[model samples]
Target: MNAELEARRVERESSRVISAHARSWQLVSALRVEDFDVAHLGRADQVILDMEDAIDDRLKQQARDHVLEWFAGGGKAWVRVNDVTTPFWSDDLSALAGSPGVLGVMLAKTESAEQVSVTHHRLGGHVPVIPLVESALGIEEATSIARAPGAHRLAFGSGDYRKDTGTANEAVAMAYPRTRLVLASRIGGLTGPIDGPTVGSVHSLLREQSEDAVVLGMTGKLCLDHEQPAVINEEFSPSPADVAWAVDFLEKFEAGGRVIRDGSDKPRLARAELITRRASYFHVDPR
Candidate 1:
């Protein structure tokens, strides 16, 4: 059984290749073991096994056991563990230490650099740890948190953030926190931050929310449902028009000896270069 589990673990690790530019991050409740299957993950670029916020206190152990079983059975995913201040955090770390199929961990309710450093250490200091900044304090400490050891990237816990600050869920109301996270990630030399999930069945609304996040420099989004990934992915990715414009601009600039005509030329060149690179990364061909 041990050898078979190891084989499965190796196979699982080898087969699942998640991109750093993955836009759709779907979170599945650890309590719902059935949802861990590939079929249920839909088009999500990545999946997170949520052990915090989704499970009740009484079922924490059961949830942990289920996640371990899934990993043992060849499931691969990032796990959203409880906050550092919680009793569940220690047990969560212990259960996940040396576990196969753990892509990384998302530390919930992270408000300080110490929490991120401790979680990273507990996870053996190699696995990526994304801190979910969810409160005023976390937002205030955003840069420090992003600079913490093992901080791969930051994610916004928008719902909890709104609740914490009595702010509305509107894009205008949420922009400050989202912008803070984006700036912090950049300053910390990390990739763009992941925006929080949208909570609704409406595809148009999801796209709009995803677009808002994208405009605020969030390259990825946490999604709540299987159907939401496609929308988030589409919205977050560079559009065909953008690719076409980038291709045209680069060709013209190269043909013109790459001369900067004015102040606007520099920013335009930067934008064009960025778009083409992102297009290539996302496998989007110029139209």
Candidate 2:
């Protein structure tokens, strides 16, 4: 096929994957497999059994064992394996090769499209991979990573990126990287990128962060703890007011262009359509 046809085909497939994940605002609250049933699973839109940042080097083998046991018992989740440069990453991929329960792998500290490709190849191409960009270099390569062969989507690893670059933990300080990932997702025809967790237990902070993420075009948020998932899901969802406005706007805009074009936002109308579609698909009753 020509390049245009190939690009269209990829975009179509990416859209399919993104739509599947549209409602999964909260995902894989990274937790040890030992605590899987007791905590992480079923609490969020999705769960990620994190073996990378959550596990210490000494506990790597033990954590891997627990993860394997969980999968053996028919459990399912995305696993956040260590970075590609680490020895643990090779082992992590090896363990995941024939595992039945891994929905995907969230490759931490991903810095290139090549790493994303190798990850899929190493796992034998059985599952989709979401590259978790965590460093300055990773953010620089965000667009390429998003467009990579195995990348289902890109996720921001805000804390690590901040630490690596000596930037503050606040949203404003991180806006550059955040916006980069967002634009990269769009440019690469991938899903809206996943935002980093809002760290603290403050409810207001969580809402503010999730709302900020929504405004910046993220479809999902990574949850760091149990209390975060509910708040993230609700905040990421379309508000009653938004749904009502979307319903009203769609009716007016569909009637004709001349009546609504004065001082109205064309781009916002498209966003309204998405809000309405999501609300309808999720059976949300707008007031």
Which candidate has the top score in lDDT?
1
Clashes of 2: 2
Q: Which digits, one per residue and each the tens of the lDDT, describe model 2 over residues 217-262?
A: 8888887767787787677778888899888888878887553664
Candidate 2's error at 270, in angstroms?
0.8
- For model 1, the local distance difference test gives 0.88
lDDT string for model 1 (1-287, tens) is 36765575565545332546778899999998878875233578788999999688999999999999988876778999999999999999999999988989999999999999999999899989999999999999999999999999899999999999999989999899999999999999988999999998999889889989999999999998888988887898899999998888888888986556888988889989988877776688877
Taken over the whole model, the C-alpha lDDT of each candidate is 0.88, 0.78
- Residue pairs in collision within model 2: 28-47, 28-48
- TM-score of each candidate structure, all chains considered together: 0.92, 0.87
